[model samples]
Target: MNRTARLYALVEELRAAAPRPLTVARLAARFEVATRTVQRDLQALMAAGLPVRAATGRGGGWSIDPRTTLPPVRFTAQEAAALTVALAATDHGAPYAAAARTAAQKLAAVLPAATAATARDLAHRAAVEHALATGTVLRLHYADAAGRSSERLVEPAGLLTAGGHWYLIAWCRTRRAGRGFRLDRITGADPTPEPAGPHDLAALLRGSAAAGARPPAALAALDELTAPGELDEHRTTGT
Candidate 1:
């Protein structure tokens, strides 16, 4: 689980155990992470506007308001397809995507009979041809696999599902490279914008080699990549 989700889940668990808040030590033990990690999680919870409270002392811990309302829920079939594609792009390590899968299972479990069936059907049939999280510009502090750090201003094009993983294609202003970045390996990213440009979106997406423009044979293989559920089933069925 990602730090954000882990923190939120811990808070929920703590809240359920209500008035019986858990110390950072206990939450860390339960999650098998460090107490320091739990502390950071608490800060994240507060930053996200969750009513998380922490206490210090031999008996004190962390607690959240039981009546706090969470962010809104809005999902379209297109968005769902995009999410599946994003998950496929993860090649298996995007923290939030993993949390999302858990969330999806939980949602499917609690949904009424008809809705559950409809959801499953959507899961099985939805086709996402675009990147999952697009249009959200980001200012990234990137550390290369070798540990070199650089700053990048990116216009996130989309997450591409390729080679059994997800990669983020963005118009990067740092090295002036149209980069395809593995989302999971990224050390950190923050949502922020840079000045808009006169660049053409059509040309940017269509022409970037980061799009992994393919030869005829590779393009043929990609014919199947367009389906949002193909990879999920492959992952689930071990096919």
Candidate 2:
């Protein structure tokens, strides 16, 4: 198993063997890895702020304190999928991204194989949130409604979600003014360490013409597809 998965397994194994310490040698044998590798993994867990303690006497090994850690969870595939999607989508703009990823990994470890794959696929998106939180400047690879492309350096200002679509409200160096770049149309965004001067979200929203033109999320127009009588046309014949 991968290190990430094994870490979760390690926790579970230790928890199960708790009240009775399992030694490094025993842990290595259980996980089928070398003693050194097991040591490294245990170190990693401890570094991640988990309370993995090593007991030094007879019947001693390494284990997580049950009081410090949670018990095992059993989540259905549907529940796991829903959580994975929500976490992945929000991770783009959420704080403590590393913690979020770790939480996802922990859940995936005990989850089904398919859910584990889903969690791995959705793994990190910390850069965007980190840049915003730090008020850093960012270089955006952007496109307009007409598909015209340009690279613009922008001061990270604020984000807006209207009709379920996200827009980055920023002061565009290229435009020499504030603008809103639709999140989906932004092909790439590389954050720079240069400090971003203060730019108010309210001012950008009011001043930027592009902000008004940003489209809603694709599913925002779902009502049109569900308009009255639309589904009738596709019904099977000979009913």
Candidate 3:
């Protein structure tokens, strides 16, 4: 499990064993992680203002006050998907970019195992979107349509998804106009602190609108990517 989910699970574990502390050894065994890792996770939870208490000395462990945490809520598969995607959107071009991802992870932590797995999988779309949202120039090692490679700096303008793929719409400084770089073909991407100069996203979208570029085949792929409980079933039931 990722650290985000593990932190939540750790709390639940401590809560279940409330009134009795579970030693670092036990907690580590329970989570299948090293004891030192559990210590770091506990420290993180405490930093986040969780009411986590660590008992010291021999026979001591960790526990949380039951009154401090909220009760659980059930989420349907569609709701989980929507929340995951929406939180990812907030990570882009929003004031709460960091908090947004944290919230998404916390939301997944509270979900059922199957649902949480699906939500986490979809939330990874943020991994690509994040590079575009830095509002700065980016160093990208990219391969083009014919698989030729080049390294260039780009000013991110926007991003779009279709055909189960994400395209970074940017003003290619070399081209002096907008170009779409498919995310998968972008072997490496690093956002620079240097702020990007103003560029118009509309310029890119205009050509796409004229081309009717996200054609039927691409739209079909989009439908499959977001088709309700299909993801839940596929991940959980393997059907």
Best by lDDT: 3
**Candidate 1 lDDT score at position 78:** 51
Model 2's TM-score against the true structure:
0.47
Ranking by TM-score: 2, 3, 1
lDDT of 2 by residue, 1-239 (tens): 98867888899998897767889998899999999999999998887778898978776788778897877666777788667544543433358655665665556555678776654443212334556788887777766666777887888666655444566667887767766666666665655668889986555544223333332343122221222221111110001
Q: Which candidate, 2 or 3, would have the higher TM-score against the true structure?
A: 2
Deviation in angstroms for 7 in model 1? 12
* Residue ranges of candidate 2 with Cα displaced over 4 Å: 57-59, 76-167, 172-176, 179-214, 217-239
Top-scoring candidate (TM-score): 2
C-alpha TM-scores of all predictions: 0.33, 0.47, 0.46
Q: Which stretches of candidate 1 lie over 4 Å from their true place?
A: 1-134, 193-239
What is the lDDT, from 0 to 100, of the residue 189 in candidate 3?
57
Give per-model CA RMSD.
12.8, 12.1, 11.0
For candidate 3, write residues 79-108 as lDDT tens digits.
976686567445334687777766676665
Better of 1 and 2 by TM-score: 2
Error of 3 at 36 (Å): 8.7
